[model samples]
Target: MAGILIIAHAPLATALRECIAHIYGGCPARIGALDVLPDSDPVEVVAQATAEIERLREDNGALVLTDMFGATPSNIAARLATVPQVRVLAGVNLPMLVRAVCYRTTSLDMLVEKALAGASKGIQAIGPGTPAPEYGCSPTPCAEAAADAAEQAAAGATDNVKAASGLSAGVLKPAGAT
Candidate 1:
């Protein structure tokens, strides 16, 4: 079994662990959240989280999940990435946490993929189109609704990517839109 660690700004780590427990029951021997203060030195906090991570690694190879890419938690995790037994992922969310706990026995690479996929799926919007066809929804109309919903989702995803890449949504000229 793989060991999991979560390091995040403030109380995010604790909240995420609670969410995982709620979704899949409690995880045995997993470490979540380093005890630190807002005014605590960054290096000290990192060192604390790292120590816990190392301890968990003794039992099994460990995966560290953090809240943001360049934030303190992730930066601390990055420093420990040189350890062959430790792998780190940023942008940890409830879905990713749940998936990690669910697939704790899987290989590291597969677990990372599952966590990423779960994070992506977690952000999706649920509407009338997402319900099952057996819920008194007609097949043909349901198909059309699903297609429309998917198209909207794609558009939203593209907009988010563009925004993250520092491109203004209005700056991108659609091929067929004026």
Candidate 2:
């Protein structure tokens, strides 16, 4: 019965809400988004998000996630943090949003931690040598091959002097060239 509030810049809030709905299935009644309405003032947006937070708290405590620290949305969330049953986390990412939706019923403190952890885990590198392939096949060579092809193409198209000097075509200054 608890809620998760998402506050982001204009236009982004709606997209994020849809993404949350897609990932978590059927939008949550308690969930709220700021900046969706036309010409919405920051204070009004905060109040609206806060209203939802209060509602959720009456039902069960709520967790609020904002897109950036010290931004309007996060500032409002910070104000709400003083409330006894509310918790706020800034720098919200897709992973944190999804985790919050999935664990909406969790304790406020635990949900905050889980959302932070989800955000952190979502940023990990997905390149080769990162356990991406079961057989441990390296992807470095593939990247190097692409780079080599690009270099070869550049070398073939440019003058030898430019190539020798490590400068792209049309990049040399007459005064600087010997």
Candidate 3:
């Protein structure tokens, strides 16, 4: 099993773990985190993250997830990647973390793919005719529709919320646009 090491800005990694606990009842073994504060020492964080990764890795490889590409957490993760059998992925999110936990028993490469898929699919924008949040509407913001909306916007076209109006008519529609 590949160990999960979440390295992120202060409190984010911890909060993500807590969220997982809240949803699943308990934290799984081989999953850990390193919270990098704004004023923390970069070199020290590197050393600490490396040691933590080693501890979590145990007999298996480790999968590290950082908040963003060029931030402190990611920089430390980059350093940790020098360790053998370690993988680092940026854009740590709730969906990605949950998915990583579920698939942590797989190979590091496969875990990375699963985590990315979860993160990408987890993001969504509001659509019209979607039930109000109180009504329990499921949202699925299709990327192609969003891109098309952007193109329309750049072309000075007005967006009408009718794109997703079919939800109330038993005609399921893609999110963001028709």
Per-prediction tally of clashes: 0, 0, 0
Candidate 1 regions off by >4 Å?
35-37, 58-60, 127-178
Q: Give the TM-score of each candidate.
A: 0.67, 0.65, 0.71
By lDDT, highest first, what's the ranking?
A: 3, 1, 2
Q: Put down candidate 1 lDDT per residue, 90-140, tens digits, no spaces.
A: 998886776665445445776687678777766766697887548573322
Top-scoring candidate (TM-score)? 3
- Best-to-worst order by TM-score is 3, 1, 2
At residue 22, give the lDDT of candidate 2.
65
Candidate 1 vs candidate 3: which has greater TM-score?
Answer: 3
lDDT of 3 at 160: 41
Overall lDDT per candidate, in order of appearance? 0.62, 0.62, 0.72
- Which tens-of-lDDT digit does each residue in 119-170 have in candidate 3? 9977877588645566365333233323434565567664342231223311
Clashing pairs in 1: none
Cα lDDT, model 2, residue 98: 65
- Ten residues in a row with the worst lDDT in model 1? 165-174
Model 3 residue 146 lDDT score = 38
Question: Per-residue lDDT for 1-178 in model 2, tens only?
Answer: 3577777777676777887566434565667776544465767766787677776663457787788798776777788888777788889888777656544444567567767877886677777666765556433221322343357556674443223222232111122222
